[model samples]
Target: MPSSVEPARPAGHHTPGPPGPAPATPPSGDGSRVIPFGRRTTRTGRGRRTPQPPQPERVVAPDSPQQRLALDVEAWFLAHQATLTDEAAAHVYRTTLDFLQLMLTSSHAEERLSPDEYQHLTGMMQVLRDAPDTL
Candidate 1:
């Protein structure tokens, strides 16, 4: 049998020939580089699932007080509903803004009020509404 090893070539001509398969990667334009080995693998079966584009995030309207307030109320209602029954949360959400003027005047209306304070006032209203039956 022939020897397993081939005699070594002289320097500068020692590069081995191709191992008999076409390269998996497309050739680069310059041909000056071959992609490093093991960077890709061939799949034998069905192709990979292409990733889906992400759904766009829900964006709050900028610089609009009404939109911001509506979104805040919606978010608050969702959170409140998690702790309380749906009917109670709905009642609070509907009636909370009904007393906005009263809350503003009571909370020192000379200065600006925050959305959170308004939400707090609504929560107080919810408590007050339930207090009568509890007594």
Candidate 2:
């Protein structure tokens, strides 16, 4: 006959039972239904729908007076390339060439100068033409 005490099972053996239903979630404090984890909640207030600030206008006006003067100085250096002194002229020539090349490369087509820009360039040319040998 079998003994009253049950024998111990081997290391990995076990009996299976019926699966239980999933646990119910707790109610929210405000009395609204609670969502599951990893979900975003909808915003409640109208303040959440605030509009963005307007962007600034972009104007592409021509270059300013100082820029025109710089160009004029550059042109004077170019026209007097032969007269530039050995000490100063080489450096000035290289720098002016670089500036002129950059201006030309950036523009899609050659831009016509304003009357003021032209006057500024011509005035600079006159000064270089009349300046003493010391310059």
Candidate 3:
């Protein structure tokens, strides 16, 4: 007895065409297809790209001997102030007051002191009275 089986269709027949490579696609107006390697593309709306504003340059002053000396004196005074005990600080305070009063009296006698200087001297005297004497 002969078998009654139909012949199987070939794979190429089902797909059609000689499979001779895919057809080339035309480029889209949006430029989405071609990308440069290692570079990214940004989508900017129809406006023109504006250049960024320049940054302001910083100005620095050169250090001078007088300024350095002033800083050194300030630092030394701060260190000395830090090391003082309450009793010693009180004594220093009294001494400073006496010295300032002497200077103010001399300035008054010489008529060389400005009103502002006299007022500042008085303010310093008041501050010394209120300040804690020792560290």
- The residue-by-residue lDDT of candidate 1 on 12-57, one tens digit each, is 4434336677668856775534334463547755777878999886
Candidate 2 residues 1-135, lDDT tens each?
Answer: 224287845645543322565347644485433333564558667677678798764432346444454456556766866434454664665566556645544442344665566556555544443232223
What's the CA RMSD for each of the models?
A: 15.9, 21.3, 20.0
Put down candidate 3 lDDT per residue, 35-114, tens digits, no spaces.
33664558555687778898864332345443444344445557876422355755675687788888887896788888
Better of 2 and 3 by lDDT: 3
My TM-score estimates for the predictions, one after another, are 0.24, 0.20, 0.34
For model 3, give the 10-residue run with minimal summed lDDT. Answer: 126-135
- What ordering of candidates by lDDT runs from best to worst? 3, 1, 2
Best by TM-score: 3
Clashing pairs in 2: none
Q: Tell me, by lDDT, which candidate is best.
A: 3
Model 3 clash pairs are 86-134
